[model samples]
Target chain A: MKRRWRQLIYLLTATAAALFMFLPAAAETPVEKGLAIAREADARDTGFRDSTVNLLMILRNRHGQESIRRMRIRTLEVEGDGDKILNIFDSPRDVRGTALLTYTHKFGDDDQWLYLPALKRVKRISSRNKSGSFMGSEFAYEDIASQEVEKYTYKWIRDEVYDGLECFVIERYPLDRKNSGYRRQMIWIDKKEYRTLKVDYYDRKDSLLKTLTLTGYRKYNNRFWRASGMNMVNHQNGKSTRLEFSDYRFGVGLRDSDFSRNSLKRVR
Target chain B: MGRPAYASAAVPLALVLLLVFFVSRSQACDLSGHASVEGRFFFRDALFPGQEGNSASVALQPEFYHGRRDGSGLTFTPFARFDSADPERSRFDIRELNYLMLGDHWELTVGISRVFWGVTEFVHLADIINQTDYVEDMDGEDKLGQPMIHLSMPRDWGVVDMFVLPYFRERTFPGEKGRLRTQPVVDTDRAVYESAAKEYHVDLALRYSHTAGIWDFGIYYFRGTGREPDFLLSADSSGKPVLVPFYVQIGQTGLDVQAVLGNWLFKLESIYRTSRDRNFFAGAGGFEYSMVNAASSGVDAGLIAEWAYDERGEDASTPFDNDVVLGIRLALNDAAGTEALIGISRDLDGGDSMLSLESGRRIGEAWKIALDAFFVIGSSEGDALHALRADDNVQVRLSYYF
Candidate 1:
């Protein structure tokens, strides 16, 4: 009986020791760490319901020429799927009253519609053109869409400081390689808020193409964090775009119907 | 003459009164407007006797809206344009003077408004709501807003819209001095109407539309005076051979569908129309495939091909009957918003063809420049476009938007 007890204790000790060693080893791997961080960030961003924001985009060329565009964005979050977004332009008189509707999916391609006020018609835009610039801005269609966690695979690099704040430096590779313009992206996310602070995009040739920086983050509804300004600079072209956001309203009772094609024409 | 003058003055007086009432009563009313000045220069000389080689125009479009947060609104949009070269093109229209009320499952609109329905790129075979403003452009995209009471109801199946058109609008035509015209000028003052009610004939339209997955479908029916007029060769008071437009009653049924799959878009538009003179069917089907970021650049290029068919064969009103169109579109994806498109339509019955090129780019912030070129070649003598075969021209337009 004593030998039996001794054997059982030995087995318990061996199992505990194995777990102690394996847990740290698994946590030390960058892939696992990165996935955990992404999951946490995604969880923290859930349940936003809906949000509306006004944006002013300033574009600058290599010669320092500047132009400005104004638009409004409305978003509705869907559980277990991607979000629905509506964008309405309010400036540059010619494109005024133009609206774009997007329905993103967690997997596969997204659906997009462009309503041209001049033609008084809604055209179905190819969502495969996600890599193309949006409305002459430096931002691509994918950049403005609600980023889905499943669209990429993540790998944690190291902990670093960005803008004087502690951040988790991670790398993410787009899962839809053919449609994505970037080969990979390195992101710096703040530790406390899990809000993205900076991102560096690498081209298909694995060369640095653009860098995006976010600043002036403000908390909304005591839970959601939003950046007030974003700047994207193209390394090759020496051109840049700055987005300034204002007039954010949350939980405004936006429903699925409000994001429909019918509502696109009615958007003021 | 006295009654007509009074009726003309009453419209403006009523509009002014409505504007005053809305502004005084609704605190949430918003008023906005935009003015554009455009200059168009044609490369070719005048094709007709009284036509000019260049023109300048100014347009003002103002909108007034009074609404609450619940989507109930009264909107008035007044559009006016003055052309220096073509008096017939200079006009004023109440584009949308309507009262809109919305509910959870239904919406209602009353007054003058515009509705467009079609999917194909080469031709809009299913669009039949508004009368064509022919003098505005040859593409048949510009429309004169129609006076109607529209009601739409949304259900699990689809959205159903019913329109009660209270009046008919005469299709406008190019003047004698216009660049694009027939062999004989059309006498708009002597137009004939099939219905004794004339312009007072009430029309009706119904449409059901729905979208599923990547496909959108619509079915429509319209019963009214046909917008396309059949001409009768007659002599005017001056003893000149003139085309007298005859507006006939028609019943039309239409279908439009679009499917978006990956980088490809397929569209189809079909219509069947019947009139006292003849019954016929027309259709247009096409596809557009795009290559995003072609050759590692930010430019997007799209290839478009479409087939258009009409049952009337050689007797069809337009030259596009039984034709095929192929085109390419290029989007620069630059800060200047540059885009260009080139298309060619070849008539299947003959070797006749029409080639068109359109390009536009923004200048700085408020200015835009557009270039358009059209060439008609090898047209048969009997073809409608044969009259203006030498009218091939290139136009450059510069516009300032505010």
Candidate 2:
């Protein structure tokens, strides 16, 4: 009789705790709603394992002079972490065999290594220069890095219609204010598929600096969404960069050993 | 540092063509490289008999490669240069002509290739795979292709690379007419060797490299004829003094390490060499700190400092017995990829000092411009850099890539 009474008390407490935690959806603040939405978007992107893509970057100045760069990128998703990436240049002839390997973390600085083809040597590089230009293009290193929701604090601004689709406009501020090039960013996320449609970057002076747009969304494995192209326009400088991606392959069976430092020298 | 014995490109032209024909039949053939035109101007008058003031050179290095993404590969790179002043600088080489076979856990390479090892910036104390191409660059950054059979295995603990070098390459030296040549010049034709096998001596090397967290390290052992030779003063047939290079058998072990923490990078390279003549330990250590977006500007700035030490002191074959180097690097985050680095080296024992500046910028899609200037601040006759005091020069190179 005594054991049965104790078990009844425990069951009653568990049910009460579950109800208290699940029944407060309407009472959530704007911050909580924004975080929830970010989490949902992140959850949808999980389980990709690995992916590879070939891309062409076209850079143009105000004078309309254009240049082109070709490269290949391989990425492996890590559980409870950021990602591991390998970037190899394929054009300009001078740096054709140069490669860069990066291991990003959800927190703290990323680990990066550069493989110099002429010397057949690898150099350990600092990733603190996230705001620096990448390959002389309009895209900053931070813009190309894997985005983790924990890097920023978000608040829901409002619901709006963008490009004939219902969207949620959220204001996000970088957690690393001292080092980030941007003061805040406004993100437009579509509601139906939870896809990021566009973003407006504000400089440290709280003024508009750059805008990025994603287009031609494609579904892979009938689950994951990927943008076929990206355009980044720098407002402060009259320069823009457009990235066209091709040959997207998912689940290529990549392992941690493939991202090792020794692998950098062999990525012909 | 293969000698100018390969006086003409015609020697290796047929061999390169034969390999190129065989590799392109399957798939993924790549043809690329760069052509450069360089001009060098000296600030002081010539100090030796064979005089020099200004020189110009044209160089071409073209690479042909064919490979499968996950299988074997064939690469051939031929280098040639034509100089207006120094005959020794007019040379030809096969920088890389190799066949690489890849397996699930190991890779093998057969033929000539370049191998670099070290982590320090100012000085390299642990790099011993390939001989230095001294005529190409006094900074010792350029290396001659070494003929070897290399095997590499990658495991969870570390990566192991073993090399069997069947042929020895002699270090190249500037000729009597070269601007940077010493007072008496080096007599390459009179080089001596302690080993009876001489240039045909076999060499063996093994290395293991690993990365743990933010640290990457390498350990290596080499047994062979030493790359850097001791000099024996001798008189030429014309009754002129000349330096005869004397190669000794040696065994060397090296270690290199690097650590990255935030914006700071620390590096170290050291070697302990034992030869029939003597034994010595040499080391180079340094640190670099980068400041991105300094003062709210897009330009990145980096501060670097390093120290090199050798147990032989003033009697060392190479300079840097005890020296310190300080440098600053600037990168402008622009479309043209503008960057520059200024450095200064000071000899702790002899008070010899020098300052150098190297800068480069990209032009459009397939062209680049590079500039380098060197100045000697102080030197004496007994110092190693004394021979270079009057050789202060500025060089400009324009490269076109395809």
Candidate 3:
């Protein structure tokens, strides 16, 4: 019985030592910690290859008037840069067959194209308007675009419990000041899943402008987590927008040609 | 050759639908489009003898689309209009009815389709595929779909589009009582063509387009009967003075280029043509610079400047010849999606000026209102816009989408 106790203690010590080695180092700075967390989140989402989603956007003004816009999104992942995305409008019948194609980059401005079905024309549009509202919604183009780790500089603010989940509060400053609408964003990410739960957007004047809450997250492919709904409320104007997502297909076989400018005309 | 080259405008759309109906089995078809009612008010008295003032019109454009799981689809769009002031404007058109099949590196579209090619604000010099629906609007931005078999191949370097246009649709003109019509009106029933095939002319067109880095360019060649008609002063069957529309055969080579540099966009469109009667050159170039979210407001303002030049100069049939246009575009970026564009064009040689405004706002969910105005001043006898000096008009349209 004594021999068995000694063997069990040895086994427990070896397991504890191995777990300790795996823990994050205590000497990490706030900036380093924030960056590492972001990198890990990004790395964990690398191999989704392609995805398709159906979305509904509800926009409401302070007067209680509401508007609706429906669309479909198809995305293809890239290895070293930003992803390629296709946006096809399904409602507001005038723009039903209209589509937009975007090829985002890691460092520079993205390339975009807009197709107008009435004219049967494809127009190359400028992407410097990242701060402009998308489809007249409260959500800006920068908010929906591919999120790359290189787009911002990060700093860990603190740790907190949000909605019964332990989270890491981090502050991220926009690197592309010329185009980005925000000066900085405060984010709360779930510690267990690296999923972002909330964000506070500060305008260029460094004033609190909007707050976004993400909810109804579901695991995709047993690896990636996606929010089923996102709520954005503007503090300055009392306008809010809710984006509801559904019918998600991950790792869908989308070819590169489907994201080309030629394909922009075929999004009927 | 080719069974007499017959042409019937309404037959092909029906044929396309019949063919696709038998092939479609597993998809739900969708119906979508817009219906609009508009009122136009003329600021001045009509200039021509038969011209009248103030008009009301209703327009409907409906689209039906069916897609299969095999990457093939069928689409049908039909347009109809009724004008209170002009009989010619009360007409129907098969705007588009086509079957589209997609392949790995290629795509094919059969039946009636509309294709547009150009990069300009006021005029698209390089676009010549479909005949203009001139009776629809004064802006000449509307087109009637053409019967075609289009094949496109996408490659790493560029895209090649080839078209086999089987039939030609005649250009619509304002009726005798229309405000924008010529004095004697065009006698379409007695129209003549340089080719004996007339509306049965089988035109061919091909274009090679490339999107490189920040530049998008298309070079094209078109061999066909020209859409623009030169009117010959003649007499009607009853011996009254009339204008007979005449079409000519022509070969055109055109190029359109655009460069996107951040907030700035540069555009150019040029066309060179060789016809049995004459050869000419027409071109336009411009730039648009946008200021997004300016002054911390959710507003975008874009400044535009363009110059149009034609070898025919004052003798050119279009008003864009030898003119400079300056414009501003604004968007509110609000939930209502409000936008406006205002432009003023000055003729260099004739020294006349024209002003235009197009503004729109979305109402609730599926309704919208638009206001458009056009004004011309000091139009000389030799100027292209001389025919419509007293036809300055403002139009208000309310639309419902479904």
Candidate 4:
């Protein structure tokens, strides 16, 4: 009996050692699980909201010279696969009257339309080269705020402190060259909330081209975080554009019909 | 801060070739190219005197590339052009034959190629990198082919650009007496000697771009010189090269400045020449050559203004003469969410006034078309005039980029 007890003790010791070895390589940790939960909080919220933004764009050449123009935008954003987006603009001189329409999609290309008051005609814009510029701004159409997770391949590079908040630094590479103007991007996700605090864009040349900053996060439905303002500045060019979203409302029974091309003319 | 190193267009090509080689050796890669053929039809209401005629031409541009990361690479851009209406009767031409030698931060290109220099609508002496736009004297289409060696840095000191061409091709002279005639005539036979007298030249250029406090800047400079045509050259026996002089087109120095504020963009350019000659205008139209001739000085200047919104796109081409302009651009979507644009431009030159407008719409997912119409509101004389009619020209283009 004494010999058997000794044998059992030795066996238990070996088993404990093996289990310790595998622990470092084990499943997700509570910290990681907590981070994911934060990310899903806002992502799962299906809400409807109307927002207005005022943007200004300016360009200067090699000489110390200046020119200016103004833009006004009204947008309605809703959560879900078939969310609706309507954008109306007040163009500067020479541009006079112009309006735009966009329908968001979850798994495919979105629908778009433009109305020319001069020609009294309504036209549809395809998704080809959707990576092109948006309103001569440094931002490409895809560069605008579309947080579709599947559009990119993400890797958690590390957990680090950023601006007083612990954040996950996730590196994302676009999966489809056709849909992206950027080569790759790195984003900072706040540990407490999935709200992106910052983003860095790499150009096709794999050069760090632009940086985006998000601020003024307000909680919605006690679960979602929304940024009231965002700014993107092109590092190569001395140009910066800012967007301010206001008057947010969510979960107001929105549907696909609210975001159709036919509905653009009817929107205020 | 150190200047960013730039690889030539070769890096991508090399990456492709390496991928191909690796593929043959059972490695993975991606290779793609677009093959296309384009044709143009020309109808002339008057050829020198008065007659209605039609002409046609076909062109093929083929691009090929192969390479891999940190490895050897190769790219070929070859073109063939054929025209039935060439006044000089040069029916077929090979426009490009280039080979690239690339390294990290630097790219060397050697052989025949076309270099684009200016950013204006109407052609000027400053736009001499290639002769196609200037070769209207060849009757239907002009072939501005040149043999050259070039160095291009994709990125360096906040600037990306190219250096190229060491010579000029002499095409036929439009003749002196024809200057006063509404419709001029050219001796096609004499045009043969022009290309044979190609003069060697070299151009060095650099572009630096930056932005400050809501404004962006685009700065550029070009300097070079060599032999060029003389407009006074007679078709007679004493064809003593009248003005076959070699001087500056971009002068020994050229500078351009562009700025953007809000939705507005402003551009200004100036060139300083050491000496000016007449042969530069030999084969070009009377009105066209005069602007280049007017600035037979040490310096010339140009300027422009532009405004645009998401509702439309603007022309990349700059117009000719007076060096100054004002313009606006707009883009808007429909009540049904379609894309459309409107644009307007005005020339600031004295009296040779011009106004242009353009509009485009996306038909569907596959194609979008735009129509551009321009008219000369006033006329100028004695070297600054553009003999365009009030109801002048229009261009319609349909493009699809997939």
* lDDT (C-alpha) at residue B114 in model 1: 82
Clashing pairs in 2: none
lDDT of 3 by residue, A64-155 (tens): 88888999999999889999999999876656789999999998889999999878889988897789888888888999999999999999
Regions more than 4 Å wrong, model 2: A1-23, B1-18
Misplaced by over 4 Å in model 3 are A1-27, B1-26
Model 2 over residues B21-121: C-alpha lDDT tens digits? 77647558877899999999999998888867899999999988888777477888889999898888898887888888887888899878888899887
* Model 1 residue A200 CA deviation in Å: 0.8
- Candidate 1 residue-wise lDDT, B188-247, digit = tens: 778889999887789999999998888999999999988888899998898988888888
Error of 1 at B398 (Å): 2.9
Over 4 Å off, model 1: A1-28, B1-12, B24-34, B37-54
What fraction of the true interface does each of the listed models get right, in terms of native contacts kept? Answer: 0.70, 0.73, 0.77, 0.00
Ten-residue stretch with the least lDDT total in model 2 chain B: B1-10
Q: Deviation in angstroms for B225 in model 2?
A: 1.1
Root-mean-square deviation (CA) per prediction: 3.1, 4.8, 6.5, 21.5
Q: Write the per-residue lDDT of candidate 1 for residues A58-131, one digit (tens) a residue.
A: 99999988888999999999999999999999876667789999999999888888998766788888897578
